[model samples]
Target: MLKIEEIQEIIKLIDKSSINEFIYETNGTSVTVKKSADEYTIQQPAAVTAPPVIQQIEKPAEPVVQEQAPQIAAAEPATSTKKTVDYDYEIVSPMVGTLYHASSPDSDPFVQIGTKVSSNTTVCIVEAMKLFNEIEAEVDGEIVEILAEDGELVEFGQPLFRVKK
Candidate 1:
């Protein structure tokens, strides 16, 4: 495992370099640092685990006291409550990448709230590595909400939009 001083030195090197991302792995340990516009993200390896320590405590024997059970309120009827309708369809990202709402900054977003979309409708662009992949809405529905923001890094299976089916 890398020491704290070593990790701090690595971070300083990254900040001084022009690289957007840096990754290092060795002996089952891995570290990743990603830098974008104004922020930096770091992914550290899981902590090393040690064997559990066993301990013993002595207590004096005493009479057992019974406690009264707490009462729970009765549940209300489901029909008496108002609930918002949920969307059945969601557009998810296919890979880990940065999401783009439009082809260019000056262009309008492909889909907005209440915008109807079909299987062939191109909803957004996901840039991974150096490739730009256009994501489409596989289900026919109206977009109810965009779960991801433009230029944000998205992970695989992350929901990008909620569509009303």
Candidate 2:
């Protein structure tokens, strides 16, 4: 809370300054005092950060190549070579967390559509409680569609992939 004298002082400062807006910070208290059109406003921040001294970096996109499709297919989902069976299964997330495609920073992914899988095969990994848990296939199927993006936070019962078993 501010004292009446402090409020009066702020009002006096506003009347004196011709600038459209003003802001000041001290101790743990910071206030953004501003005037827009004919309205006056004040906002106090709960947390503060020291203004950074730096420059921004920009990123450029790599050129797309048609030859990379095969590499991307292999890189994104490395399939298993084994027997097959017929089953209808929906690959749902086991928990509420972020979904990951690859196993490690340098490694390729575990599974993708047209990738042969068994009931014990790990299709993807989900992160929960700061721990990565392997999501396995309940039944063998070809991944028909991926319903979520990499590093996307998912909820329980979220359809991660639609499988054609």
Candidate 3:
């Protein structure tokens, strides 16, 4: 069983990190921490000697579309003026992590706009839990856009770059 202070510390760490969910188990006790939007929920068994009881917390839905109506309307003209070319492929992040354009701080980015890449060419690195994962282009194409910025926290399946075959 986790003490209150220990559980608080874990919550603090998770809140600061990019992790969406964390689970810890010891003996027969289990603790789960989950983050949804800006809220955090901690779920744990009430006691070790009793049957585990699970409780769920839910939030009421907000009118997100209504709130963004003005912003979408405002950007319509700008989007209409720009030429829309359908991209052939999108290089996406495989996991939730911080995106790094270069292996090191002083190194050049692996790929940039107009840079041609092979299927196996590394385009960027996504650092998750201290592991630096080299992201591949996966398709032969010229990079048309770098969507995510360096050192940005990116979610799983988030587009990192757009490519034209």
- Each prediction's total of clashing residue pairs, residues at least 3 apart in sequence or on different chains, is 0, 1, 0
- Sorting all predicted structures by lDDT, with the top scorer first, yields 3, 1, 2
Q: Please rank every candidate by TM-score, starting with the best.
A: 3, 1, 2
* Tens-digit per-residue lDDT, 1-165, candidate 2: 344456446645654444545566655556555543344566667656755222222223333232211111111234679556433677898799989988885778787767877888888899999899999878876876677888887889998876777
- What local lDDT score does residue 25 receive in model 1, on the 0 to 100 scale? 64
Candidate 3: tens digits of C-alpha lDDT, residues 1-165 = 667667767667665555656777666677777755545566666435535544333434433332111111111223246556568999999999999999999999999899999999999999999999999999999999888999998999999999999
Q: Which ranges in model 1 have alpha carbons more than 4 Å from their true place?
A: 1-85
Q: Which candidate is the best by TM-score?
A: 3
Indicate the worst ten consecutive residues by lDDT in candidate 1. 68-77
Give, for candidate 2, the lowest lDDT window spanning 10 residues: 67-76
**How high is the lDDT of residue 93 in model 3?**
94
- Name the best candidate (by lDDT): 3
lDDT of 3: 0.76
Model 1 clash pairs? none
> Model 2, stretches more than 4 Å misplaced?
1-87
- Ten contiguous residues minimizing lDDT sum, candidate 3: 67-76
